[model samples]
Target: MAGVRTSLRRSAPALLIFAAIRALGLVTLILWSHAKGKDPHQLLSARWDSLWYVRVAEHGYDFTLTAPDGRVLSDMAFFPLLPWLEQGVSAISPLGFADSGLLVSALASLFAAWAIFLIGDLLHGRRVGITLVALWGMLPVGIVQSMAYSESLFVALSAWSLYWVLRQRWVAAGILASPAGLTRPVGLAVVAALWVAAACQLARRNGDWRAAANRRMVIGAVLAPLGCAGYVVWVGLERGSLFGYLDVQAEWGNGFDGGVAFAGFILDRLTGPAFLAGAGLLIGVAVAAWAYYLCVKQRQPAALLVYCGIVVGLALCASGYFGSKPRLLMPAFPLLLPPAVWVARARVGVIVAVLSAVSVGSAVYGAFWLNGSGPP
Candidate 1:
């Protein structure tokens, strides 16, 4: 109990920072919705994929949509953890599925903020941890963390999974990765990180490979892919094909294309009327590259490097919905390490003021974007 209190006290700053930023964004969204004659809560909990998640929660899988041209949009493309959470929470509470989703996401975002703090604290110190968490909340697409979406839950699981890996708690890491797999496709990154760490441990055992193959490591590795594999198998069985899950994603124009399509997208933007958007995309790419370089320079753990590398790679190489890139990349928390270190070196007042300004900007931009272009 004392340990828990200490952790909560240490994590308070980051948690408060995240909550404040999210509140600002939500308030902005409320005002924006009022001006546009839309429902604020509905905007967060009823639109887009949120509705699909609620459908899956209230009525099991098998929910799908048929486009005007007859293309089948299956809800199976979405992983199951978030909906399962919504359903479970709603079953024991009076809240509806969408409200439960929102509640879960809201609480999960705070947990994610805390997990991120733990990672940063482990990597550097408490100050850097607080800064890192604040930076995450200031991300332009940070609003997604508060929506009835799975990003928050995935991030929380991913961060804690990485934290367990850092602590060399292999079994715990793998267990966390299972839920992460159930949350997002990029959960593979967590599995790869654990596998890479285990392989490294085995490599370091000299000729005693057998000694390195401990029960914990073996069990962890075995468990890591279960959620993803199980869901894929279930979808395949229901759809009458082994590649049913892939087909579902393909129906939505999503697939891995080695960044070829993404490159073409940039080229199209460069030559199109949305030149400003293109410029922003280019800047984002440059920033990501610079952050990766910084991570390399700092010599982050191999597990982190592998995990972040895969997350960034997958998000960039995805073939559809270029606008979702920022939200998709939100799970790459290590990317914030570089900026956190830089900011932590500054005066506390400066840190708070700068983050506050950025938080405001994020809140306003998130509100405007959601009410206008929306997610994806």
Candidate 2:
């Protein structure tokens, strides 16, 4: 308990900054929504995916929506952990399902920030750790961290799982990765990270294969994919095919197309009045790719590199959901480390000034965004 308090005290600055940044975003969103005569609480806790999650919690997977085009929208397409959590929270408190989801996300975002800070500190120093958290909280889609979404939960789990993998605590890593896998489809990234890291660890072992430590490494790898695979198999059984989950996603117009669809999306934008949007997307892709390259150049651990690659690849290469790409990439927090390191090396005033500016910018953008088309 003493150790836990010490760690929390150390991470307090990062947590506080993160909370402040998110609070700014929420205040801006509330003011923006009121100005537009929209309900701020609804925007955060009851719209878009939030509604779907609440429905899944209140009901079971029995609800299916038929789109106007006659496609079946199975509630199963959403992984179950977030809805399960909403149910638990609602059953235990006065909060309704949607508000419970909001509460879950709020707590999860702070946990995610702490895990992110620890990862940065593990690789660099405390300064970099704090900067990394600040940068994550300043992301344009950072507002999503405050919404009734699973991104924060997934990131919290993924980051902690990766941290354990980095520390060579195989069983703990696997334990965390399990729930992470259940949180989002992209939890596949967490599974891959654990497996790859375990493989590397085993390869470096110059002892017997049956050693208890090696056994745990194997166990971690084996346990990593169960959550995702279990859900997928369940969906498959329910949908009457082994590929049922893929079918459901296909109906929802989402799939991995190896960037073919995304490139086409950018081209379409470039050929129209949205040229700047296309250019911005192109730059975003370039920046992400360059950051990955730097991670490689900096020799980040295999797990970190693999996890970031898979998350970003999935987000960018999805065949549809063009507008959600930014929010989708929120779990790929490792990409923020390079810039975090640079910021850490700068003067304190510069760091504070940059973080403050981006935070305010994020606040405005988040308010504008939630008030506009919003997350799909």
Q: What does candidate 1's lDDT look like per residue over 1-376, in tens digits? A: 9977999999998898789889999999899889999888888899999999999997888777998878789899999999999989999999999999999999999999998999999999999999999999888888888899999999999898888888888889889999899998899999999889878876776535454445677788888888888888998999899998899999988999988888888888889998888888989988987898899899999889999999999999999889899988899989999999999999989987898889889998888878875563
lDDT of 2: 0.92
Off by over 4 Å in 1: 207-213
* Superposed Cα RMSD, model 2: 1.1
- Please, what is the whole-model Cα lDDT of each candidate in the order they appear? 0.89, 0.92
Error of 1 at 317 (Å): 0.6
Residue pairs with backbone atoms closer than 3 Å in model 2 (clashes): none
Give lDDT tens digits, candidate 2, residues 1-376: 9977887998999999999999999999998999999999989898888888999998888888898999888888899999999999999999999999999999999999999999999999999999999999989999999999899999999999999999988988998999998999999999999988888877888645599988988888888888999999999999899999999999999999999999999999999999999999999999889988988888899999999999999999999888999999888899989889988998999889989999999999999988887463
lDDT of model 2 at position 117: 90
Q: Each candidate's root-mean-square deviation in Å? A: 1.5, 1.1
